[model samples]
Target: MMAATKRIALGAVVTALIAGLAGCSGLGTGGAGSAPGAGKESAPGAEGNSPAAAPKGAVNLIGDGSTAFTGAQPELPRAKRLKPGQKPPQFVVFSWDGAGEDSQKLFSHFRAVAKKYDAKMTYFLSGVYLLPEEKKELYNPPQHAAGRSDIGFNDTEGIRQTLAELRAAWLDGNEIGTHFNGHFCGPDGGVGTWSVEEWKSEISQAKAFVKSWKTNTPALKGEGPLPFDYDKELIGARTPCLEGQKNMVAAARTMGFRYDSSGVGNQVWPTKKDGIWDLPLQLVPVPGRAFETLSMDYNFMFNQSGTTQGDPDKHEYWGNQMRDGLLQAFDRAYSGNRAPLIIGNHFESWNGGTYMRAIEETIKTVCTKRDVQCVSFRQLADWLDAQDPATLARLGTLKVGQKPKPGWTAFLAGTAPGKAAVGPVPARPADQPAGKGPDGSGD
Candidate 1:
């Protein structure tokens, strides 16, 4: 009798495994009238694990945010892809708001670091930073020092130079884009006493300035092989401060923007109100407080107070933490069929802290892990397009500026790969448009 019972139990276990793998799930079948085998399946929720779900992919791991505080993506190409057992992909970007000497140095450092990774960063420059002309004076007088630069603050010249550099970076396979002309909060909020309309003008001015650069630079001016591709020029942009959502989106579309990496973490698509794409920032973990809420503010780098400032002891500088958070978020997304993690940064922090160096080291370490790909914003946008049409369709239907839910954020926090499985593996073919191969280069 004992032997016969043992054989029956083995048969039942095999049957359950087969049924689970087959995805034999049902609705309203796990309650009072629950089926005999239904109770064994995992529960349903943001953190739930359905027995039928497919395994997550590793290459799907990602991080999004400003590279200015970290480094420039254009400089480093090899560091773009994350290999198996690697950390994550940190998509750093920039916001070119102030024309201070510190800001310029920050931008230069950003370019230098990105070169090391062969990645591209999205640069958001304001109109004031690129004024039509820097009203220079032959005589050095205190009169010209009123928010005016005796040195490099010419609107037109500054913007032209900035664009020229960005164009060069682009020619080298980097990325570029505009920040509103006025440096402020959303068009609704004022920045240093500027009004909404004034802010709008700043964005318009910045775009126009960039247009001129496209028409003037020898490498990028006309239809040239390296810099004159219409498709190439269409890929640059980040909001001034991720402000003026409605106005910024509408203006960018009117100005012919192809994609906008302004939003962070939250999945978005071209809005019905405006056709511009929203590349949201990735959710980065706070170094010491890896379980807290990720801040949406762009100035988190400038502010040294609170959790936004970051923890340096654990190598959790803003850049490291952000990148780590991004990896965790992407791991969660890959596991749950969600999208990539996005984060943004600025150049201000580069003036002092080890932001740039930290970012470079982190990228060198993380991007080569598992299936992570260190693509430019444009590349990411392209990969996004190649997603299953059904998935893209669902993404498209989502409204613009949809904030992440608390439950989802909590779920992402739980999936951090700190010494644990990084999660996911690239089952898709290498030539399938997302990444290269295990070598981190295209076949």
Candidate 2:
């Protein structure tokens, strides 16, 4: 049963969210339903939102006030400029797509895990999760019928749980980016077919859902608002199926997004595409395989299980394979170019939850290591923005597995690598496409 209809100062469900949804969702998850600690001073409504989350009082609402303008976010550490000759820290970003707290409660679970590790991650929220299933028709995604969504819709409880998790996630200093909506992947009018205007529409609807969930979810009128102003909080995203990246980047750049994680790249310093940071999923070593796969669980599962669950007996082996692959990638960077490592995941318990265990174990193994900083995409972007452009350009010259020829101080002293030393761009594949992402995350 849905929770009791709770009324607050927000008044009747506003009609703002009914406007054509222009949004998306990406990444994936399988979570438990427990309410995990948000790792902050517990709010008045610690079980979920805060008393001031909604408009019970006079709140300065931005735009149509679907979202309120809160003050500067807490706990964000100002980025520091890397000193000359100082080696860059190893950055590992653990991100989630389609982030929500369902019965699995993976959203909160991982938030807690990140807190335990002194890490902060990015959560790419699907706008639909904030829009109740009954109101699905309002979504009208491009290339799909009204109410049509590849990932289905959320129930009242699901929405409540997701809202709670999102509230906690943000307060804990994690990023809340978008995964868009509808999750239309594949050749049949997938994201690839979307025009720049269509992507803009998608992006708009994505923001609308978060901005005005109170209007769509009558039962949540008094649940309080999401912790931060999503408009200011959101600055990045990952595209579904990793398709339509070219077009998405074009659209996202104009929308003021700072970065995108929808492409496949080698583990190297990042660059810009369409003016937004192109933080692509990277190719990491896959144990027992000659070729590496994206640093995402879906890719590992796809390669190991052939898109099937695979042999139940081999689940452990598969899990270890993923763990080993990520570790190898981590070590290569920690000991090599010192470029940030980007790892993506979903919350679903695919392949008997082996991947989750692999990720959990990997987090324990490396997140606490010296000089390893498990950060969010936003924080990484901030740090990158604080660096010397010439330093980044120089660091970009180091290929994956290729250390600075002499050392970090000399190699990145604003000097270009030798033709042979630079090698091919590390972590980027030349022929990557838009839809090659793992089952639920990036290509």
Candidate 3:
């Protein structure tokens, strides 16, 4: 999504400008080494490491982008077989559009909860966040923006800071994925309203941005931070506003994305005729707003007031729904229900202060108590692909009160740090003196 006028002279400025244009910004675990607690240790195929053969009887807990509500999946009947090898549903949490301090706070919040139970946190960032640090060449966007000051997008300085912090977190071990910028169906004037072509451009550009960082930058040199070390074309996404379009899916696959988390539990796979992996989010519903959207789950977690598009209420309600909804969903799913509990949130909706505190409360009540497995999308994918013959049939009758299988906790705790890199990673170029320069007054 670069401006057509001209390329920026300095990489950093151009990067920031581009971010301004894009309003850029910026998971879970599952399977054998799965569980909310599984995150404490390392798994072979997790993050960027080589895939280890999954052990027998491993169950993955999955989640999706930021969203959690009460009585959302009110009627999911259980699975039939409830077999040992079958993968459990996921809880994939997305970082709402682009990157910011909220992104970091959300990541930190998720990290705290996941770590408390040793669960993994899945993160998706906007490419704009990486521009100031990774694309710092004079020939980059920064130069162009510096020259014109307003020619491009991005808060070169702010994004730079966020990237530095994110890099550090990834090194500590986290799943960093891709959340498409300007593609989801957002509020009026939101990025989602962009044309299909613009949406395609957005997705491609974000992927390209990350790909460049993994290969072109010195700071990221060999550290293999997430979303980078793994598939150069990490194709996971949460549509803005959870809105899904047919053309968007086609564009995503074309751009080399392999997964889409926009689908809801009520919808089946291939719902759109495309072969894209439909990682539908399972959402809960608020008591009064049940009639609003018949498609996805109604969220009671956010108070039903205020000007927020998603929740009419501005009150932070994640704490109220976390336990009752999660336990109820788990009970329904384990008892052979086909419905998966899809929890979600926005960067602004669930970060720091009350939101963070609420999530922590939920973790203590739900994840730590039962067989919950907060998992990554890929981990869920792997588990789903390995289901036994009778597993699907047993969803409706699975029992509760059984001791969660052992071994995953050990795996989570036993994880060794991935490939070592020398020296500390770099700060955003905007922070460096190199970033201050002669205004690109033009040629």
Candidate 3 structure quality by residue, lDDT tens digits, 1-443: 11111111222212211111111212110011111111222221223223332344332211220111111111111222223433444333323333333223554445545556645444666554454432433212211221121112233334334454454445444445665543323343344345566567566666655555434444444442332233332656765445544556777777656667765443121222376567665433222221111112123222222112333232334234333334444443433322334444444442123343444555555455344555555444434444442332232222221212332122122224332111222222222221111222110
**Of 1 and 3, the candidate ranking higher by TM-score:** 3
TM-score list, all predictions: 0.51, 0.82, 0.54
Candidate 2 CA-lDDT value: 0.72
lDDT of 3: 0.38
For this target, which candidate reaches the highest lDDT against the unseen true structure? Answer: 2
lDDT per residue as tens, model 2, 100-194: 77666567778888888888889988888888879999898998899988777776667778888887787787889998988887667788789
Compose the digit string of candidate 1's lDDT tens values, residues 172-282. 555555544333332234222343454355455544544443233333233212232232244446543443455556555655565775543332233223565566543
Model 1 TM-score, 2 decimals? 0.51
Off by over 4 Å in 3: 1-104, 132-157, 168-173, 183-198, 213-227, 230-233, 267-273, 287-303, 308-327, 334-339, 349-353, 388-443
User: What local lDDT does model 3 show for residue 228?
Assistant: 24
Better of 1 and 2 by TM-score: 2
Q: lDDT (CA) for every model shown? A: 0.36, 0.72, 0.38
Off-target runs (Cα >4 Å) in candidate 1 are 1-104, 132-152, 155-164, 186-203, 211-226, 229-232, 264-274, 290-327, 330-338, 393-443
